[model samples]
Target: MTSKPLISVIVAVYNGAKTLQHCIDSVSNQTYLNKELIIIDGGSTDGTIEIIKSNQDKITYWESEPDNGIYHAWNKALGHASGDWICFLGSDDYLWKSSVFEEIIPHMIKAESQGTRMVYGQVARVTEDEEICCLDGDSWEYTWRGIIIDGIGSFAHQGMFHHRSIFELYGMFDVSFKIVGDYELLIRVFKEGGNAIFVNGLIVTGMQIGGITSNCVKLVNEMARARRKNRLRVITIPWLISYAWAICFPFLNYIIGERYVRYLVNFGKSSVTYLSYKKNVILEHKNDQ
Candidate 1:
């Protein structure tokens, strides 16, 4: 691999004029220079095309046309990709810092030397007001185990980089999926013996509170479908209960408010996960005894 292999950053948009410029500007300001920005707009009429046109000099390739959802646009971007590695960026998300790729590329080169094909980093989940919601930093063990056992998300696309060959080997994003396609593809990656190096700092951040994927019920359903298709067994009871809670949580929030709802939900989740882990440990110890 070259000391500075070209990286293709693919940004997909749909009526995202409001946040598109910030996303493009973040890519343009990157300290790393051997990169290309590919933008695929799903026929946005909300001035998103104008944003793309204005930034053409910073972009390598782009198109605006009617297509499927995020994953389909992702597939289109993949088709046009011409870099050694590629990553998807949401139009509503931006690199956490201008030096993100500059810091990440060296690791990619090292990983290539060590025969690793994927690399991921921490993502600071933030809200529309730029307030941090949470930080994601799961390593391969945790991500692989969590998805296989719990059907939960252990990574986000914006914070991860993939060597172009992985896609050629594992196939492109499953366009039939709208929300959990990344999760599904990741399952295949892990199952096929693919691994990632976990970069130790914040790579990207974005609004955590909205978007089509933010609908907890739909996300849960899509994830369950993905898990089933991949033949990974996961307990359905807790997820079903969570789905019910998701349906009622909005109404409950309307009454009790966002802060209280968030507090209660977080407390419940932490307590349940803690108890589950404890029980599993006990069961394993008993079997050992």
Candidate 2:
């Protein structure tokens, strides 16, 4: 491993043979050379293991075997990361283009120099056939109205880079969450009063269809728990408005289906995620999942 890595990219897989190789390749092509990648598999019986082994040289660090879920794999990856910055890009997701981290790293370092706790950027959705859609881009703007109510949009665990110290101070991913563990982790970052900045530039491929994160019900439940964990300051209007948005998501997706919903619902989600993105890294397995 390089003694001075600018970023550590972590990809967690559980039987994701079809997409795992593409995800790994995306990391290998990163514009940033001073990077290390960690692949933690969840006891996959599929060819996913073979694909990883084929790319063993590119994988700076990796592990195979059963794990609890995405967060568990992520927790394992964290221990092996030796970079100044960290992020988890899911097995099914890949950055849409090359040099995915190029636009954002300098800005992240600048903000970190100013003593900011973290830096987060925008994300877009990539269809199975590879068409792209924006979640938070030139097309949208989101603001945080209230603490608990802000999880409405599509800021993925993939879109942001986190500071390692934030995890040291806060704690690690809570495993109790079945779908929205990442959301719960964000709230903990907020409660700790971590400093962060929203980058106008975008990063990573996110807001995809068919992923566990695409489920509105799962998102709602995770947001509900995240709010509880943070002990929201007040029952703000955003919280009340969120209930309306939550109710509409399922029916909207059913009618519009996954493809169009990315352009529709994710606009607010990506913007909201900017305000809502966290600085926390996992410290313990308080997984309430």
Q: Against the hidden reference, what TM-scores do the models get?
A: 0.88, 0.82
lDDT of 1 by residue, 1-289 (tens): 9998998999989999989998899889999999999999999999999989999999999999999988999898998899998888788888888888888888899989988888888776666676765666566666555555555665667788889988988898898788889889888777645567988765554534456765767877888888788887755544555577678777877898654565555455444444555677899999999
Model 2 Cα shift for residue 118 (angstroms): 1.5
Kindly give the stretch of ten consecutive residues in candidate 2 with the minimal lDDT sum: 277-286
Q: What local distance difference test score does each model get?
A: 0.78, 0.69
The C-alpha local distance difference test score for the whole of candidate 2 amounts to 0.69
The residue pairs found clashing in candidate 1 are none
Residues 65-138 of candidate 2 have per-residue lDDT tens digits of: 87899888888888888878888888888765676677667767776677766677766677777666655532
Error of 1 at 243 (Å): 3.2
* Cα error, candidate 2, residue 4 (Å): 6.2
